[model samples]
Target: MNFKKCLRCGCFFASEDSVCPSCQTKDEIDKNSIRNYLANNDTPQNAESLAFQSGVSIKNINRFMETKEFSPLKNSFK
Candidate 1:
């Protein structure tokens, strides 16, 4: 089956569902929210370095990356 991730909680589930189990209790944003989140975040490497230096958890950073909500680094893989 094809898979589409939940924009609210970043959980991959049955796309037919109206909401993700994790974010079902809270308000869920539409496609616009996801685009905005991606644009607002995902800064440059300098910011990522600063966040890391300031003690942001690797897990959280990675989680954000997977969400497609965070665009912290443009050329992160490079």
Candidate 2:
């Protein structure tokens, strides 16, 4: 397996995924949090607002928005 730098923790690991194994769990949890927030509330204007209201960091919000599952959400933002 090719080594890649973990996007969340900056650690080098052998994986095709963006984050390391440990961080993958955290990513799942954060994604759940975001989904819960969006399910109950109106979509925020942008990542910053979503991050603030969802208690997730803007960095993570931005990162999540890059994925195919969340890419449409990025288009919703200004």
Candidate 3:
């Protein structure tokens, strides 16, 4: 795997790790948040619009929806 420098701390490491160990902030999208956005509404819809409505980032929504790795937690939104 290729290495990348952390945006927050300037630590160099493998790109496979989502965030730098030095920085708690995530470089990759959060799937749980994305799933919460997608597995909503009575009607099927676009991910971007869903993200807007759900107040999650569009990039995160797109990543989860496209990857199809969204695991919804039941009754979480309620």
Candidate 4:
């Protein structure tokens, strides 16, 4: 079995996921907030701006971007 530490919780888990299940739930919530913010607003935002506006962390946003989960908003960067 492969064991890896979760980036968010720093707990070791046996999986290929970057974050553990608990942190994944929280990340989902954050993602929803970011999506809602993007849907409701037209202002261009970069990782830092999005983090500030959505109350999410820059690390999480960058991770999402890196995984291409937030590719639609990638072009919104200013």
Candidate 5:
């Protein structure tokens, strides 16, 4: 199996996903939080604002926005 570095924790692992298993769970939680925040409030101007309001880190927000699942959100940010 091929080993890849975990984007969130910098650990090496064998997986197709960007982050390790543990971080994947956190990513999901962050994603849901972002969705809920968007549902309740207007879209923020950028990742920093969204991160601040959603309680997620700007790094994760930026990473998520680049994914196909969050591609639609890309338009909402700068």
Candidate 6:
């Protein structure tokens, strides 16, 4: 099996995924928080604002955008 370093935690993981399981879980939580925030509020927000409100890093938010994990706020990022 090929072992690779996790992108988020920098820990070695024996898998093809960039982020480890732990980071993946955290990422899900962050994404959920951002989704909830968007669902509750009517105004559009940029990545920086979402990161600040959701306590997730700006980089992660950008990654989410690239992956299209959250479609509702896809165009909200500037």
lDDT of 1 by residue, 1-78 (tens): 657687556778876654467655442333344345446765435535534543444444444455444554435534
lDDT per model vs. reference = 0.49, 0.92, 0.51, 0.85, 0.91, 0.78
Residue 37 displacement in candidate 6 (angstroms): 1.0
Residue-level lDDT for 5 in candidate 6: 93
Quote the lDDT for 42 in model 3: 41
Candidate 2 local accuracy as lDDT? Answer: 0.92
Question: What is the overall TM-score of model 3 with all chains considered together?
Answer: 0.44
Candidate 6: what lDDT? 0.78
Each prediction's RMSD over C-alphas, in Å, is 7.4, 0.8, 7.2, 1.5, 1.0, 2.0
TM-score of model 4 (CA atoms): 0.86
Winner of 1 and 6 under lDDT = 6
Span of 10 residues, lowest total lDDT, candidate 1: 26-35
- Tens-digit per-residue lDDT, 1-78, candidate 2: 799999999999998999999999999999999999999999999888999988888898889989988888988888
Model 2: worst 10 consecutive residues (lDDT sum)? 68-77
lDDT of 5 by residue, 1-78 (tens): 889999999999999989999999999999999999999999998888999999999899889978988878878778
| Deviation in Å, model 3, residue 67 alpha carbon | 1.9
Worst 10 residues of 3 by lDDT: 69-78
Ranking by lDDT: 2, 5, 4, 6, 3, 1
Model 1 lDDT at residue 44: 34
lDDT for residue 37 in candidate 1, whole number 0-100: 42
Candidate 1 positional error at 10, Å: 17
Q: Which portions of model 4 miss their true places by more than 4 Å? A: none
